[model samples]
Target: MKKFAEIDSINIKKNPFVVGSAVNPNKPEYTIYLLIKDDYLFIVDCGYFTNKRTKVSKWLTYQLEMPKAGLPWIVNTIENKFFKLSHEGGLPKDVYHYAEVVDGEKLMIDRPMFLGTRENPEPGYEIHTNSRKEGRTPKSLNFTDSFLFEHGLFDLFKDVAQKIESGEFS
Candidate 1:
């Protein structure tokens, strides 16, 4: 089995384009992304920021098992949202954790959104009260989608970790 270092490199692609004609009363939702192999479009994160009643959301799931021999590379993408707040970049343990997991990886790209987890208790959000008071604004942003990145995913992680521990890398 080859190590992460013994792998080829891949690049992320980016480009800018306008959505629609001016004064059309419809504007396209802008996005950022990284181009990986296999034409797999792993959208980082995207949504409307300016004045608009419309929005777009993205969610995906895949259970990709490593090859019996080994993986070509292990990519731990860091979503761009994390960089919006730079306070934790100073934490030693956070730095250590990322370093330990990466172990000199084949690639780490931060395109539209970062593609990995954060090491903190996320300041959670609840909106029943806000909507109750402010007439329920239709346009709001929820970065972490509930159905996609389920908070109830701890058990699943444990199961995967257990499999890895048992050398069940299929």
Candidate 2:
């Protein structure tokens, strides 16, 4: 892989359109906001600010994004990003341990949901919860695609895509 000398050299566009959003069922404290800019799709984590709701100040706070590629590409990018973050001491040691064993590329992406694994035999997606105290271990929660969809994730993405086609998002 080639490395860019500067972040701006990547040529990312600004003012990404907010497409959709969904709150995690297993962990309601965090919400996933969908955004898009040309060739990029952003699955952002907007942490809780108010009771059972998220504040705009928290949008894109997690800084997670990927090219509008296939499912394999998305999963692989997510795993690779976390792997790099772990090495940089940005994530907990336990997450790195899980990341080592869970190969995102190998996970089944036929289902539309976040993908990952915990200590269990079955593969699933992982979400990290922030601890109020500094230096506390972030809690990792795992859930399936069906679970997320049951809680409105599927509808969120679908509605946004429809809106975009109708020029409602522009």
Candidate 3:
């Protein structure tokens, strides 16, 4: 199969084109590919199941395509968009929410719970991103879940999606 970097041109009308990719700095087994076709975005995990014959893309390739300064805003904007979308669906506005706690002698803070299981009882892992959300509820529209955050691929995915939406990458 063709690798992402080797793609020089794409017939987006026919198929989604690879816009960028990210690899987990901590886990080599985690990698993601971002693609766009028309106005929709798609992310594919090409990390665990691949063999020697399965082509993969590199995070460095995506970094090299854009200026370093663009990363922060791109990430923030994407997070904001995700937060808003989730909020509209009755999901919490915060992908992660912090709660304050008190110890007898000292105040303490708890780390934010990411898409806490309390909100959605079914396990997230039970459904692949490729599958539609259960009940096809409005919440399903908030498809970009905490998996991207936990995996450190959220910013990369957002940055790439922003670039594609801005017509900076086609």
Candidate 4:
């Protein structure tokens, strides 16, 4: 089996290639790869996994306590929801709704996740990003910057799907 980095070129056609790197469970780096298979094309973002954006992430950030507890929670949340599609299905307009807090209490308890840095954070995670609401929904359009707020979260499910598909992922 070849290490993913050396794979070089994807046999798929038209699809964007996906690349990812991780050592720490929290902060995994991701990128997109364009691959074309049999005359068709697709784009795969690097941060395709739910638990971490890259491979062997949890192993790298082996805090023994925090990373273990936090990884599962974050991964589970993304897998449960989020939507993604190609230029064909068209990116869902409601994609941003993902960051919406479905369960306030349970969600809040896991605030200090190891993935996103919170220590001495210049722009602390607590402050909501007013984004991702672009063409989001009537419920969010009223907010001044809601469209941009959820932009980061909009890809929750999308990444997982891309990661799972051997046609795109492997």
Candidate 5:
């Protein structure tokens, strides 16, 4: 049972779009924001220090619609940017837990048997170096899985603007 990095602070605010936030307990100065903007879902991973503040450590934008093969197309547009940021060397590496607020209820999806777990996971692909550990392991990182899980909810609201534009749904 490895000890994974826990989410120290988390705040979520909802409006026409949902903004979900998670702070790394291992690194208090670092945070990740998952937002739904228009037809796309974005993951903005940022880091800041006393001397210098980073603009955007990592930014990933994924299309809301599913592919023809019935798969979510989540892509990390910003590549290797997070590596340059200052941290304990293992940033997202320590953060592997995930949670979501649905219908005004906060749901915990951190278990390994959940939808976004190793045994029964979500539909998509991820590029991670470490294997999924039983508990929160420093070497076990699941940032990609966490993003995809949140994106699943974001996808539900993505077509609203488009449908409104076409006057199909009001």
Candidate 6:
């Protein structure tokens, strides 16, 4: 994995290569990987069942090859849904909407939820944990840390995506 940028202590990296699941779960688990090449930004979701893997992989490859002209739509969609203000000191009942079509199938991106209190604020952003997976035992690769603000992770991701789309960084 190539390091891209570190936002609010969260390191964004280029995961061009597929990685094995950190935890084995009864149900298929999902993980999102971010990558950038020149002016293009790629977002990949891994861990569908074997039956769905080929289709998902094809979709991801197509998405990775998409032109930068489509990036604005992605950034705007995420911003509108992700940057909304929520109730303080708790996870909001609202969920951010992010969906992509692959082989006519809709695949939704999992937006990190808000967690913890004002004094000990925590955003539900864990890159190496399979706790979010359904029917999976809570397991962590020990990659979690405390964060303040309801939209901390969302804001960081949005900012980086926007910057990359604008060609602000090489």
Residue 169 shift from truth in candidate 1, angstroms: 2.8
- List the candidates' TM-scores in order: 0.24, 0.39, 0.35, 0.21, 0.26, 0.31
* Tens digit of per-residue lDDT, candidate 3, span 19-53: 66666443366445556544334444443434556
- On TM-score, who's better, 2 or 4? 2
Clashing pairs in 2: 116-124
Alpha carbon deviation, residue 88, candidate 4 (Å): 32
Q: Put the candidates in lDDT order, highest first.
A: 2, 3, 6, 5, 4, 1
- Candidate 3 Cα lDDT to native: 0.38
Candidate 1, poorest ten consecutive residues by summed lDDT: 17-26
Strongest candidate by TM-score = 2
Tell me each candidate's RMSD, in Å, in order. 17.3, 13.0, 14.8, 16.5, 17.8, 13.5
Off by over 4 Å in 3: 1-16, 49-78, 81-131, 134-154
The C-alpha lDDT values of all candidates are: 0.24, 0.43, 0.38, 0.28, 0.33, 0.36
Q: Between candidates 3 and 6, which one is better according to TM-score?
A: 3
Give residue 91's lDDT in candidate 1 (0 to 100). 25
Residues 1-170 of candidate 1 have per-residue lDDT tens digits of 12111111111112221111111011124222222222121222232344335554333211111221111111111222233345544323333112121222212221223222354223321111111122443212122223123532223323433444355542
CA lDDT of 26 in candidate 5? 36
Off by over 4 Å in 4: 6-77, 81-112, 118-149, 153-170
Tens-digit lDDT track of model 6 for 24-80 = 121124344444555444444444344455553312111122223334444454445
What TM-score should be assigned to candidate 1?
0.24
Q: For candidate 4, write residues 1-170 as lDDT tens digits.
A: 11122223223223243232122223344333333333222223233234535433321110011111222333444334322343434235544333433222112111222223455222112112122122552211111111113433324324433444434432
Runs with alpha carbons beyond 4 Å of true place in candidate 6 = 1-28, 48-64, 78-157
Candidate 5 shows a clash count of 2
* lDDT measured at residue 91 in model 5 versus the true structure, 0 to 100: 24
Error of 4 at 146 (Å): 13
For candidate 5, the lDDT comes to: 0.33
